[model samples]
Target: MTDDADESSTSLLPEPLRTVTPLTGSHRDESMDVIGWGIFLGLVVLLLPLLPFILIVWLISKVTESLTPS
Candidate 1:
């Protein structure tokens, strides 16, 4: 008996997950980097200052509601 193996068999995973794409183009790399930095800076600039005020107001509301007679 002769043993034979087929090379056409594929796993259940998607092709993109199994393959690696190269990012050698400068424009693609720069665009991706800029987008990532923009998201990071946007969150820091916009949300960082408001977070503390939001927490303080939430805590004050909770305390006031608890202290007030129902």
Candidate 2:
């Protein structure tokens, strides 16, 4: 009975994880950087068409902020 209880208790505990692989490479780092920059530039490019709208909104917000009392 004691052995069964101990076995059950041990079974209830979580198992330890196996070893994990680490990343190490200049080419990988460069590719990742390129991907990151591409994503960033893509976002900027996508937002390019909305730049004027963003500027207008910003100007309106600033004007409102200036006109409103604190």
Candidate 3:
């Protein structure tokens, strides 16, 4: 009964892995910076066409508000 209790209290991990060091950095690759910028620029390029549409909608709303009675 005591042996069963002792076994249950013991750790499941191996002895070497019982202690672990804290992480200080992700060690990301330098080339990844270019990829990140590329993705950001690609999103900007995709959204550029929508910018004109958004401006048109905003202008139409302003014109409608000005024409409405107070």
**Lowest summed-lDDT stretch of 10 residues in model 3?**
11-20
User: How many collisions per candidate?
Assistant: 0, 0, 0
Residue-wise C-alpha lDDT for candidate 2, range 1-70, written one tens digit per residue: 9999889987866798766888667556788889999999999999999999999999999999999999
lDDT of 1 by residue, 1-70 (tens): 1232233343354565544866565446788889999999999999999999999999999999999999
| lDDT score, candidate 3 | 0.91
Model 3 ranges with Cα > 4 A deviation: 7-32
Clash pairs, model 1 backbone:
none
Candidates ranked by TM-score: 3, 2, 1
lDDT of each: 0.80, 0.91, 0.91
42-66: candidate 3 lDDT, tens digit per residue: 9999999999999999999999999
* Prediction 1 global C-alpha lDDT: 0.80
Give all TM-scores, in the order shown. 0.40, 0.50, 0.56
Question: Alpha-carbon error at 64 in model 1, in Å?
Answer: 1.0
What C-alpha RMSD separates each model from the true structure?
Answer: 9.8, 5.9, 4.5
